[model samples]
Target chain A: ADTGAMAAARTRQAQLTKPLGALGDLEDISVRLAGVFGSDRPHPHGVAVLVAAGDHGVAAGPHPVSAYPPEVTPAMVANFLADTPAGLGGAAVNAIARSVGARVYVMDAGVNADLPPHPALVRAADLGAGGRRGTSDLRTGAAMSRDEAEALILAGAALARQAVQDGTDLIVPGEMGIGNTTPAAALTARLLGQDAAAVTGRGTGVDDATLERKVAAVRAALARGGSDPADPLGVLADLGGFEIAAMLGMMLQAAALGRAVILDGFVEGSAALLGVALAPALADFLFAAGECAEVGHAAQLAHLNLKPMFRLGLRLGEGTGGVLAAPMLLAAAATLREMQTFAEAGVPGGGA
Target chain B: ADTGAMAAARTRQAQLTKPLGALGDLEDISVRLAGVFGSDRPHPHGVAVLVAAGDHGVAAGPHPVSAYPPEVTPAMVANFLADTPAGLGGAAVNAIARSVGARVYVMDAGVNADLPPHPALVRAADLGAGGRRGTSDLRTGAAMSRDEAEALILAGAALARQAVQDGTDLIVPGEMGIGNTTPAAALTARLLGQDAAAVTGRGTGVDDATLERKVAAVRAALARGGSDPADPLGVLADLGGFEIAAMLGMMLQAAALGRAVILDGFVEGSAALLGVALAPALADFLFAAGECAEVGHAAQLAHLNLKPMFRLGLRLGEGTGGVLAAPMLLAAAATLREMQTFAEAGVPGGGA
Candidate 1:
């Protein structure tokens, strides 16, 4: 983040035709956007939504942590590209992305099944080699090798770099992996030194029995994985899914490229925890999109010291919250760039 | 609200490719929209922003409750129509309205000065007869005659009816009257049966002294006006600004025409209180855009049982919050009308 641009944006905000700080989070958002773009007048033109899909091992076994079957992962990946009358894909993310004029890029980070070729689908081959099709069960042992986690993160960074080069100004990192929220809970609990029960939540609206299974799975994963809070990469390898690692990578890379990143919900917030742990400066480039229905999302955002922008009770990931918040960013930037100054408008008495 | 359409929309939401009730307030909003449109797939096309500009006599006296002078009302009204490089008016409301593809209609509900003819400005002549240039000081006596209050509201309804006939699906009622928050706080306190000090806030970032004066003014107004909580029209005539009364009329008329009305902030919420008081069912067509910086806004929203869609800490009214929230309605409708159902996508397990 450029401090000079940020300071300049703040000064500009104070001069706009309203009271100082009257716009609240919007004023702060505009300054943050100015810092990211390194311009006092930042008008972001393109919003890119990256939905990383993978299959979670815990979702495949008996007493699965997820409400939906594991095959729903690949099915939803295909659904992300399926044509609809709305001129977008058939899923929630696609419809929302269309609403925000954002392009959806679905990545097969580590789906259990081979996803068919599609224009909107970013193939696993586009990512580096030695990527696992899916992770091992986190409840029993390490979800994946440390090498695999690193590869997925690098792959995600590569995708974000390409997006920035393609004129995308804002990146919304979303994830779709059945039973992945269990891993996310384990990772958040381990990193934050909290109990599994404290962070674990019902994924996909599971029954009480299934929710208990999820909490138990997270506790088991933390006890067996030998993950360390000081080592984010190791923790990710032990408890994070491929999509989670990819999202972390995307956030780090997008921030490095000076583009703004919006975190979807709990799963994405877990990835953000890892990213922030590795690079504390990453917090400067990220925005928490919503205080989702997930029981642990608020806790994770609180840990990151990032205020959730909207509290729409959204629990569905795949960048739904981020896409919904894109226009707010546009509106904030427009306020800074377009609105006349108090002096320019000849309005008086802004003692603030 | 159409119970049949709402029920059908609820069913459709459950069948969508995500968990039932995952969308939170968004799901509820879509259902409400369905009830208003009488369609399971309700898609609102046009968003019309109505900004009622007026003056306040309380702002002219010594120890004014407002930070800005009364003249700033007409100045900001002109700013609302000033051309900018963004191809919209050079104000926060216009810039935001442009970003959301909403049209801004500035109505001179009762401006102290004669606003020149402009395409964007809706002259007072268009409203109705018996309109006052501004209101008497609420601190001393009734704000306006009963006839004036009734005329302003009826004129507001006429403007709303015109907007709806012109293809507006959503109405955003905004207000721009200097020292207006004083009246709004008084009305909210009177209607909610709360004390003035509890609801009075620093409107436009007032200093400590100005805030004290604002609270004293509200208390004085309530004591002298003798406004009945039961008679909303009488309450308006005694304590409401012209802009606030007009907004009340606009909301009532818009809801009657089956269009969704998004309340801007403190001033608009005060108007909504009156509208809902007159027609309790009008709550079905209303959406609180944000929990604004105003202290009384939450109390007003709580009384209406309308959960705000966003909380950006906005204090500047003129439909900024409402315009910002229009996209959320569009996205909510898109989710209902565009997304594929689980049966259509061949996905399973929505036990919710």
Candidate 2:
């Protein structure tokens, strides 16, 4: 948490062979990471990706134009692990992770159906006591209890620490929650002090009419929960999904362990908003990988004053954007660590 | 040239792992090279960087905000090769060339000073001459004679062929002409079918009042040459530098030899415009490396329909931007060579 460490890391980064600030934001991230770890030679290892999956209760009612049935969450999660045909899970993430040497793990924070036990699936649900198949209706009900939110956070943090303790130096937290954009929108609206309509956007490609319905559904949920701006966490508990809660926890825990965390798109950005509010110091440890083209994401990032690493107009969740951005992160880290310094190269300085 | 060969190369590029268009403009360059060479595995070798040095006659008079005296051109070229205290030439270029595994060649196209004989210095004075020096009067003056322009082009092409025969697969042409911006502006105006005011800008930080004078100088040159927008080569001969002429020839020769050419910023972009104009087929061989902040650069690029490799707000004219961009080119080539295809990775297709 010492600011001096961050400053020192920045100094070391500037000293690298190349023009000052030539590498752009990557240089800033590398320096900050080095400072947090208090090492000039900060080796990024034990890189793992956390993909949290959950189903949104808002998706239960077919408003029309919603991509598929709510049951798709479990189906896709299964496909993600087994590499099945119906799944959007594998491939992109697999290639990107393999390229950057990051192990991928899927966390079942909340799903509609009972998932079969699998090694790749980590059960980290946050259903309150007397919890049934799902929590009370999030549309007109509380999304998750405070204790449940804390549990999700703890689970994410624990997983990150375990990865670090197991020799992972970098962690990319991603999510695959169906219709979770509703919760992300609600959370973004509350945190950024904007109306639900201002931050609400279509999830999984809905028509204008369905988009209006989704917006109304979010508004109804916000009104049902009293949408108190003072209690931002309450707003999240009232509308946040299991995966987002998990991401919030994961980011905080990763930062607490001094590992670099790459935040992906809107869902991840919402989680970052929460993480930043909870522990302001974690903001220094977080890197905005890329922004989603979703309406609410830009507002969330603007609230954080964060610039995305890349902008390829990607909207697919499940950490695909984060995975794609990993190569750039690797390049930045490598350049920072390996590039010869101007002093080392004997280039004339401003002093000359 | 067989269009089918280019198409095949594009197909091969698309087949390389990563996203189909994730590599952006780089994919196009590599594929074009592959098509030109008629080889699936086109290995770039015998890469040469031509650093053309010249003195602008216009800089001899008092100009507002000139960085150094006009004599600095030859002196800098000398310092570029020699390891003097004030020298920036040798080290930066050497470091970049070493980084990309390319060879560096300095060409004394039209330096104002008499020089000691050196192997690195190609004494092609007639081919490297600058426009009328020391005066803003460009009405009756020509930057280079028709014979000089032809000789420079021939020399450049010869140099490129020699490099290609020496096993180089790429060539980056650089320039070091002081006050060359005057001529560069005139060439840009002619190529883009715009008046000099549309393309003229503060080169190397000329003040507001002085920039007005520079614009006037460019307009005078354009009028004096009676520059025809349809005739780009004639415009270059009338108002271009020896380095620009040589670059045009080098690019044409590189294209003829089936080697890829990486165009630098505005100065090189001007050269590329001339090259493509001289041999329309050469347009297929050049890659614009970066979008410069120069006044006429974007217009010229738009005229050529070329997208720069990067946008770092660089305007340093000593081939630094081109050198910096080499890494991206190499990265693109490596990606094409190493990325796994969807079939190879056992990933599903988008049902194309």
Candidate 3:
């Protein structure tokens, strides 16, 4: 982030036509945008919602961790890419992204099935050598090799870099992995040094029995995975899903490139935890979209110290929450760049 | 509210691609919107933000209740109508409204000075016979006569009815009265039977000394005003500002016309309290935009049982908070009306 640009933005905010600090978070957001864009006037030409899709190996056992079948992952991936009558894609994220004028990009991190080629789907080949056909069961061993994890992260970073080069200024990192929250809980618990039972939540509206199973899965994954908090990549390879690793990469790269990234729900926040672990400064580039209904999301946000933009109890995680918050960033940037100062408007009593 | 339509909306929400209740407040918003529009699919054609501006005589004394001078009221009224280079108006509300595709209508319910006419300005004559040039000191006497109070509400209702007739499906009631919070706190304290100090806040960032004075002003106003909660009109006439009365009318008429109304900040919520006092059913049509910085807003919302859409700490009360929330209503309606259902998308396992 450009400290000079941020300072300039803060100065400009005081001169805007509202009482000092009256705009609150809106003022903070615009200043952050200025830092990210390194310009006094930050205007995003393109907004992109990246829905990373993969399968969770822990969800495949007889006693599954998720309420929905693992098959739903690939099915939802197809749903996300499918065009609807509204001209938006077939999913909730697509509708919201369309409403906010954001384009949705479906990333095939490592889904189990071979999805037919689609224009919107970014396949493993595009993600580079780290991408593979999902992962082995995390309950037994590491989810992926360290090399593969590194490659996946690199692939995700490359995607974000390309999007920025293509004029996309804001990136919303979302995930679509059935039973992914099991890994997210495990990751957060391990990173924050908290109990798995405390971090675990019922994903996709699981019953009490299923929730217990999910909690056990998170505990098992943590026990088997590397425990070193410093080795984020090693920990990620052990317990993280392909999409989670990819999202971590996307956050890191987006921040390095001076672009904005909005994180959706628990799965995305887990990815952000790893991103922040790898590069503490990555936290500066990230925005928590909302306080989702997921139990661990609040804990994760508290750990990151990132105040969510809204709290609509959203638990759906295909960039829906992130896309919904994208407009706020737009409103912030517009207000900062366009609103007249008290002197310019010939109004007495300046905001300062 | 159309109960059948609300039920249909609830049912349809379960069928959407996400899990049951995963959308949280968004689902509730869509259902309520269906109830208000009397359709399972409620698409709004126009979103109008009514910013009612008035002066407060209580701000004219030696120890003013507000940080800004009372003259700032009419100046802001002009500011709200001034054109900016971005094609939006000159104020915070205008920038936010323009970003969300909502039209801003400045209502001069009572300005202390003579104002030139503009296309966006709704003059006093248009507000009916109850409209006057500001309000007297509530600490000394009644803010307006009971007749004026009733007439102002009727005029506000007429404007709301006309807007609905002109294809507006959403209405946002905002206010711009310097020292307005003083009157608002007094009215709330009287209606809710609470201490004046408990409800009074630092309006527009008052200093410690000014805050003391403001609280004292509220206490004096309430002591002189009517205390009966049953006679809402009398209470309003005794302590409410012109903008607050007009906003109360807007809420009543908007609800009656089946158009959704978003409440801005503390001043707007105070008006909403009066509206709900008059017609308890009006609660169904109102949405609290955000948790404003005012100390009394939460108390007002708690009384109304309305959950704010967001909490960006906004206190600039020219419909800015309300305008920012209009987009969420749009997104909610679009998701309900456009997203493909689980069954329609050929995905397995129903939400039930």
Candidate 4:
């Protein structure tokens, strides 16, 4: 963030039509964009939604919290790619993306099932195959070796770099992984050093009995794979899924390229927390889309010192929240770029 | 509201790709739109922002709480009409309206000074002038006589009806009344039976001394103009501005026409509260755009059993919040209209 640009944006906001600071978070949003873009005025363009899809290893277990079977992951990815009649996630992402002229790309980081090729689809293993058949069972062992984790992270970084180089100014990081929140809860609990019951939530509308199972699964995963706060990659390899690791990689790489990343709900928040642990500066480049329906979302947001733009309690994470937020963010940037100052408008009150 | 359509929409929501209720308010928003449109799928179109602009006579009083002179109201109205250079409010409203294919219309319902005519400009005085110089001081006497109030309200209703007849599918109600929160706070306190200190907030970023003065203004207004919960029209004549009264009329008439109304922050919330007092069913047709920075907004929303869409702490009242929210609402509606169901998409195991 450029201090000169930020100061200029703030002074400009004070002189806008409304009273100083009357626009509240909307003003903050525009100023932040100006600082990031290093300009007195900034414009939003070349937006992209990156739906990082994968399947959680824990879903293979008989006692799963997910209402839908893990096979739904690959199917949804295919659904997003075809976008023919679109699914709920695809419908939302596509509609908002079209409204803001953003292109949608569905990335298969590590889904367990076979997926057909499509123009808007990319394989995460193009970075390197983190694993061929999803990840290892976190309840018993490491989800992936450190090398696999590194490869996945590097692949995500490479993808982020490619997008920025291709003229993508903003990245909305989203995910689709059945039973993924189980690992997410595990990762969150480990990184924050808390108990599983405190962070576990109803993933995919699970019953109370299933929620308890999820809590226990998270505890078992952490207990089996000891985590260290100093090593984010080690923790990710222990309790994280490919999609989560990939999202973290994207944030870090996007931040490095000075491209904004809108973090979706809880699933993406977990990846961001992990990314922050790896590189705290990544927070400067990230925007929280909304308060998610997941129970642990509040804790994660508070820990990250993030004020979410909206609070819709959205938990369906195909980057839907991020996509929904993109237009408003664009409006903020547009306000900075297009709104004439009182002086420029030659209105009687040239605000001091 | 269409009960059958709402019920059908809820049932269909469970069949979407994500878990039940994962979409939260977005789901509720779309369902309500479905009910209003009498369809399982609702689409937003021909959306226009009705900025109810007015001036408060109390602003001409000594020790007024308004930061800027009352003349800023008419100037801002003119700014909204000429969007080339764009004021802050104009820039935000226009950019967002354009993003979602909505048109911007500025209404000089009762600005104190003269405003120029434009293609998208309309004055309620075309219904018949309510007063020569905006509204009278509510702290001294009734803001307008029964006849003036009736004419203003009727004009609002007429405008709303004309828009619906002219193919408008949605109305975003906003306000631009300098020192108007004084009356809004008074109306809110009266309707909710609260005290001035409780409901009065810093309208447009007033300082501590000004906020205290605003509280006193509300107290004085309520004292001078006795209010009756049953007599909503009389209350408006006593304590509401022509703009606020007009907004209430627009909502009631638009609700009757089965058009969706997106209520902006506190000022619009106050008008909607008065509308609900007049007709409880009006609550069924309204959607809250965001949580306001004003102190009484939560109380106002609570009394109406309304859940706002976002919590951005926005206080700017130019239909800015509604225009910002329009994209998300469209995405929600498009979700219902375009998304394929779990069964329709086929590769799924729908949970029981």
Candidate 5:
């Protein structure tokens, strides 16, 4: 597609009756989309969020820094459904989605335990509904087979397409997999061409010693996979979790369907990198919501050449950052769609 | 006056299921008020914003790096009413007032220009409506007479009382004086028990040489006025703007009326120090919105021992910071007012 549409959108966005570039990177996203779609008015509709829940295998080993056993993943998932007080569950997401009018769906991509029949949980797993009891043995073998990776991607695309058919126009990809940051780190290393140490940090506030171990584990996994940075699918099959692969597919499908996708924190950024790798054109549909304060997030964003709208030092990874950033997105969209242009409002533009 | 009420409020705020202290200082303010007023459910209904517009006499002299010619103050005030496309006019306070649903009133305490009649402008001057054009030889003479200082305070208090009668539950004191940062720095130095050099900083990004001159000018003014740190009223008469005096009165009246006040950035914080100096009890009603990033805001916040809710590096000094913070206040209030207790919700409070 010609970049004229995006350029026009940029012009329209700039002509809004506010300080130029004061709304921050949100203005950038809105204008870029305007140009991409060749529409002065770009409406964000059909908003959907994908929450991927999984566990880490390394937690089975004794670690002084690791808090809570891997069993907490399923328990938290149940809390999300039951609305338990103890759970850091989906309440924040539920409240934010309601506030911004977004539909949310939870995907059990690789949770160790079988999720009982629930309305919120969609069985979108690719590895035959169940995986190993704990985290994937990434050091020795593939996280999931190529077939499993393909299934997950297809399921995510199908879900996104269904959302579009159901009158949804925007997709926000979120993840809920424990120890998922490990895969995210490895993905960042491969995509950004950085060492594992550069991309690895204390996940969930690990101490210095445990951080070293986590970095070593990620380095070992990268070596075991013999991953090719140029081949995105091979990287996913080897190092990316079901959730990351699914998110990447959802992003690509959203772009194909001409829907906007609000990319969440580091894990979602990893998925976006993969999506851009698959179809470089899909990058236009994605908006970097905010920079995750996680050590690897900057590396991932730099790799993709994307800037986030806000910088509140957010590192929580349950799509919370995306939801927090929704207000800015709404403000940008409102500015593009509602604010009067200079020509229409009769406000003089800079020396035309 | 018992601290237990404040303690109970803090406990209630902490138990509301959000991250511990994530809401920051606003939570502290709400909890402290719950104790002061002896009510678990405190009301924030009486709100008033005082914008004091003034000019600095020192700016008329040879200054090396001042972007604005002192005449810009009145011109900008007029621009504020003109509805310019650049948004360079009208105080940011106007937009903030609209955002937070607060009643805004502009007071011309001491502008160098002869003002015309405007519906929004309240001509409550310290030395009568049309006194000497700006301060008289402040480097040699007194900044304002004690009577004028008292009148400014009365004007602020009178506005507060009117708002209270009109059913306002909270008051937000704001200012809009150009070159007022000079007086604010002197006031901060006195209250913080620091030297003028320690508290003084470059206002509006002045160069190092100009900053040194500004610091020297403030020191000369302090020495000339014999400004007493022990007596806030004496300091106000010698080295304060009409707006700061007005804010001091407004804060005292709000405390007397049992209403809460959301203080703005550095300028407002300087006024708050004066208010607290006049009547220590007034501190109970004053909530420091946050430390302003502009020159001497940190010193003022430190003097008050107050913490603001958000730190966005804001220094736009038109009550914008305080207005932006109103949403957080609403959030804190809503969390306390709407959230159900464990007993009411039939949920276990970690005892299970």
Candidate 6:
């Protein structure tokens, strides 16, 4: 974070008509935004949401995130492409993004099923139109090869760079997969050096029995090899999903380009854990859109030392949390960018 | 809360989808909406936001919330009436309400200046069309006569009842006044039986010297007596502002009509403390729009034993906090009201 920009923003915040620190996270948000973008009260120049869709072999595991069939992944992706009303997650993201004037890009980083070509879709350039057919079951072996992982990551980085070049100020990263949380928990546990039970959670809502099985799966995945935190590619290849690696790559690229990235939820956090291992300074460019309902997410956020902007009980993935925050970030930016200062408004302003 | 409605809602929640409590406060919110509107999935039938505008003599006190002059109140009120580009609490409320399909009502509970005549302004029938100029200085004595306080309460009650009759499912009560937090702080301390120092905060943004003076003024008001919590009306006459009293009436009436009310911030909370003394069950009908940016709000909320709906560090009270949450509440209600149940969606659903 640029300390000079932050200092300037803090001074500007004090000059606003409201009390010092009265806007709460909004005040911090504007200040951090200033630091990240190197401008006092930095608003998004343009907004884009990247939804990374993939598949996980863990859906075939004993306990899946939900009872929905694995086909739901491709079905929801198709619906998102058509802007159809799917209750899973895509519809909410589409509606919220439209409401906030954000462009939506659905990427098939890796999916087991074929998704029809759409203008909004991003696919493997070398592998042709269809997405890389995601990762295999983590319970058996590495989800992907190191080469495939690197390729998918570079693809994500390319997308992030493109968005920044197109004058996109903020990047919202989300994920959609049948049993993605399984690898997410395993990855979080590996990176944080914690027990699987602490990191595992009911993904779409499960009973105690399914939750137990899910934890056991994470424990099983850890017992497998190539789970070392020091080796970023090893972690991605061994246990992480293609969508996670891709989004992680995007986060790193966004940070490198000095573009602010607002996180979606636990899946994003899981990717971020790997992103942090790869680049510790990535934390400076990130903001939590909202608190995730997933239990491990709070721990993940704490590990990252990030304060989420709001706690809306939003467990939905697909950048919906980030979409909810676009208006607020704009409002925070507007407070400094548009609104008159106390002196400007001729309102008596006093502060400590 | 209606125990039967809550019970029914809880049972429905278990069967609908998600985990035992995956939705967090959203689960509680749905259940409470059930209690208020008497349905398992009580979505808002309609929405109305009442912005109560008033003036205070405390603006001229030793410590002012801001350096802005008193004339800014009526000037901004006129700006709000004209839908001008003043970025105070009113414009934020207007934009947020327009974003959602919520109707907005600007009422002149009391402003000291001669507010211009506007079609949207609500004034006492007896006081005629131009609107009521507000109370005397609280530094010397009562802000308004007991009769006027009662009249203001009745006026607020009438507005709430009218909104409910007009098919308004949710009521958002917000207030605007310079140095209003001073009286709000005094009323909170009086009702919660706390010290002035504990309850006082810098309203609209005041310097340390002004904050100290504000605290001393609150202490002096307490010393003037008539602050017994048991006598809610006496407390109102001694410490509360006109907008606070009116909002209190509105809350009480809304509760009586089995309607849900979302509170703005500290001013609303202060009014609610007295309302709780009048009718303890009013807590069930109320949802905090956001955590007030004011320091004294936590104590008031704790005293009421009500968890706020959201925490946006929103100290600007023009129903803006509630406006931000309108979308969330609708989404929560829609989740149960519109989405297919797990069994219906052909998904696995289990809860303990």
> B143-216 in candidate 5: lDDT tens per residue?
78888788878877887777778887667777766567778887787777778887776555566887787788
Better of 1 and 2 by DockQ: 1
Q: Could you give candidate 4's per-residue lDDT for residues A1-352 as a string of tens digits?
A: 7779989999888776667776788788888888778887887577888888888778887887687788888878866765464332344566556655666777788888777767677787766855455887788888888887787788778778878877888898878889889888988898888789988888677888888888888888877756687898899989898888788888888888888888788889889889999889787778878888888888898888878898887878888888888877777887777766676555554552
Q: Of the candidates shown, which would achieve the greatest lDDT relative to the real structure?
A: 1
Measured over all alpha carbons after superposition, the RMSD of each candidate to the real structure, in angstroms, is 1.7, 6.9, 1.9, 2.4, 6.4, 4.9
Each model's DockQ?
A: 0.75, 0.10, 0.71, 0.51, 0.10, 0.25
Docking class of 2: incorrect
Per-residue lDDT over A1-352 for candidate 5, one digit per residue giving the tens place of the 0 to 100 score:
3377667777765664333443344466667667545576665544567676766665555752233455556755564455433222333454445434567777777777877878777767542434434446676667777777777787778777877787876678877666777788888888777899988866555667878877887888888856787988888878888778778778888888777788878889889888888898877777776676678888777767777754545555667557545544444454466544444443332122
Instruction: Residues A11-128, candidate 1: write the lDDT tens digits.
Output: 9998899878888899999999999889989988889999999888888877889888988898898889888778758888887787668988889999988778887788655778
- Which ranges in model 1 have alpha carbons more than 4 Å from their true place? none
Residue A220 displacement in candidate 4 (angstroms):
2.4
List iRMS (one decimal) for every candidate.
1.3, 8.2, 1.3, 2.8, 7.4, 4.9
State the displacement of the C-alpha of residue A256, model 3, in Å, after optimal TM-score superposition.
2.9
- Write out fnat for all predictions, comma-separated: 0.81, 0.00, 0.73, 0.56, 0.00, 0.22
> Tens digits of per-residue lDDT for model 4 on B221-302?
8887566867988888888888888888789999999998888888898899888988889998888888888899999989
Give Cα distance to truth, residue B60, candidate 5, Å.
4.7
Could you give the DockQ of candidate 6?
Answer: 0.25
**TM agreement with the true structure for every prediction:** 0.97, 0.70, 0.96, 0.94, 0.72, 0.80
**Candidate order (TM-score):** 1, 3, 4, 6, 5, 2
Per-residue lDDT of B114-222 in model 2, one digit per residue for the tens? Answer: 7666766765653343422322324358766777777777877777776777777667888776677777887887777788888887666566887787788877777
Best by TM-score: 1
Off by more than 4 A, model 3: A225-227, B225-227
Q: After superposition, how far is residue B120 of candidate 3 from its true place, in Å?
A: 2.0
Q: Tens digits of per-residue lDDT for model 2 on A1-352?
A: 4567667667766664333554445566666666656665455645678887877777776463245566656755665676423232333454345434567888788777898988777788432322223444577788878787777777777777767787776678877756778788878877787898888776666668878877887777777755575665676678788788878888888888777787778888888888888778887777776667678998988877777765545565667567655544544454445444445544333111
Error of 2 at A347 (Å): 6.6
- Evaluated at residue A188, the lDDT of candidate 1 is 91
Task: Give the CA lDDT, 0 to 100, for residue A308 in model 3.
Answer: 90
